[model samples]
Target: MSTHVPFNALRPGVDAADVRAAIDRVIASGWFVLGPEVEAFEAEFAAASQVPYAVGVGTGTDAITLILRALDIGPGDEVITPPLSAAYSALAVMMAGARPVFADIDPARLTLDPHATEAAITSRTKAILPVHLYGQAADMRAFEGIAARHNLALIEDAAQAQLATFDGRAVGSIGIAGATSFYPTKNLGALGDGGAVITRDAQLAARIKRLRNGGQTSRYHHQEAGANSRLDELQAAILRARLPYLADWTKRRRAIAGRYRSASVPPSLSVPREFDAGHVYHLFPVLTSCREAFQAHCLVQGVETLIHYPVPIPRQPALAATNPAMCPVGDRVCAEIVSLPMYPALSDDQVSTVMGAFSSFVPPTR
Candidate 1:
């Protein structure tokens, strides 16, 4: 009998006891928001991210927007970002009252092309926001060089990449600041929506802390107009409980991806090449000319599949007014990419089932 493989599982497994204890601790403290739990988690996560500070926020989207706002990047400022990531990446740029310029991605890397990003820069370009798609770090070295040359702020959209590294340096530490999500599906996810901004800049971290909590400098003394986007104590405590297992979870995700990479698939399907061995494999995506048919085939084989992004950010109806430049590589990638089941909870037998589904597929000849 073939085993059914899920796209991802979120229920408590090995960390159930720890998660329960964390919830109980938070409840017993009688404090819910911006309390000891959030403070402790911020310190722990900052250390984990190899950064000096971390600020907890309500969501990943807020994390990115708060970082941009804290940098004083808004209104006429332009932020160049890849067109291939989750729409939230671009949405965050807009949320900061800045315009997001769409840049084509590297066909192989599926990340913002450095050349494209450089070409997109204008006098108004204030920052280059790069998403580390699918737990793989973007070419941060190149981005760093470009930012230095152009005097642009480099903010990493690391919502999909936690505990990911590029060239021995942690992802969140390389940029001016990095924003990550803990939306119950991340590597170090919480029980509910949560996020944080990781940065080595003390001033920037302090600014974000104020911005996330209604721009309060002190108790009831509003310094500026800030949004209410604080990460509550329960979620923080829950994330703290799960943080220790991230390394092992990342290893398991990589191991499963290795199996998928080595497995034989139909000639029509292509597994994305790993640009760096440090990838945490957030989502194991495969490209096929016939995505619908391939997905149907996988479903028939009892394996679930999803599209990380079905449409390029520039092409979305919400962004049409941005008058974004054409991103041919990103456009093609959106149509072809499909995410297979990838999570630490997947059993070896289930991993085999996913591979078996791929092996048995026979794409229709065009």
Candidate 2:
């Protein structure tokens, strides 16, 4: 048994030559860093997201951090967020100098529970950052109503969701501001690290632009102390080159997900949900109490499995130092979750092989 069916193989698509061509063109032009490539990517991304403006930045983390900074949310401010996601969500809040107040998730969807979110709000609450975990839109309609009542800023953590939508509205454009990652594993990934901020509000957009480029509207005239987090021109060009084919790749991902659902999954395993057409299936995570054992089984069966995250942000040494009681739900889910192979290039044969591995194991009837 060969390990060809590994966890995730990079599927750069047949059009990567175009990405290389775009990169070569940029190199030939001498102008690099935040230049035309970045400008064009920003404009194209805004159009794709149906937003007024889009700001490309250094990384997914910077996308979130810069958005919070632009909103002036720091120090005494507290942001409500889901407890069942990458600690990066919490890290972004801490980096912005705010407290990350965690809300429990809807176990079925593995996204923020709107009721829990509203209950968690306090006087210090300035924003609600709901992660569109596993490429499915969070219940934004519920969150929006709550945000309106409290006058809180709604920032979407859309790192996993590129084409994902909410009621026909694109994920990044739904909230006040949305942050997305172009990490190699995302639905619409870039060759290397990259990210963007999308928003409909022009004022918020202007601030994010300044935040990404050191708060200087003009050349070298600094206003506020901002972090250096601009999206690289080369990466932007690569992303732009790939953007044209996003729809096709996304459709393939959905098709693969359908196969997984129709096929035989482990009886004890809980599959991810299909919410409208918005779910992009970034990482098809499954819930299992015996995650360690399941991973071991996959290893023996020549399939690779990974935990999206094993530790919640609050429990991490760095985060625990500040807030010991950050998020209990996030902590528990991180312990029990496992991400299966879920890229567009994953073949039907590979799906069958993984399913066979699951069928081979069965728990004793208790």
Residues 1-366, model 2: lDDT tens digits: 644578877656577689889889889988879999999999998888788798999889999999999989999999988767777887999999999887888777788989889989999999999999988999999989999999999999999999899888899887799998898888778878999999999998888888888888789998888889988998898889988888898998888877777766667777766766778888888777778788887778877888877876566787665663555666667888988788888788888777776656554444
Candidate 2's TM-score reads: 0.95
Task: State candidate 1's TM-score.
Answer: 0.99
What local distance difference test score does each model get?
0.94, 0.84
The alpha-carbon lDDT assigned to residue 45 of candidate 2 equals 85
Best by TM-score: 1
lDDT of 1 at 38: 97
Q: How well does model 2 score by local distance difference test?
A: 0.84
CA-RMSD of model 1: 0.8
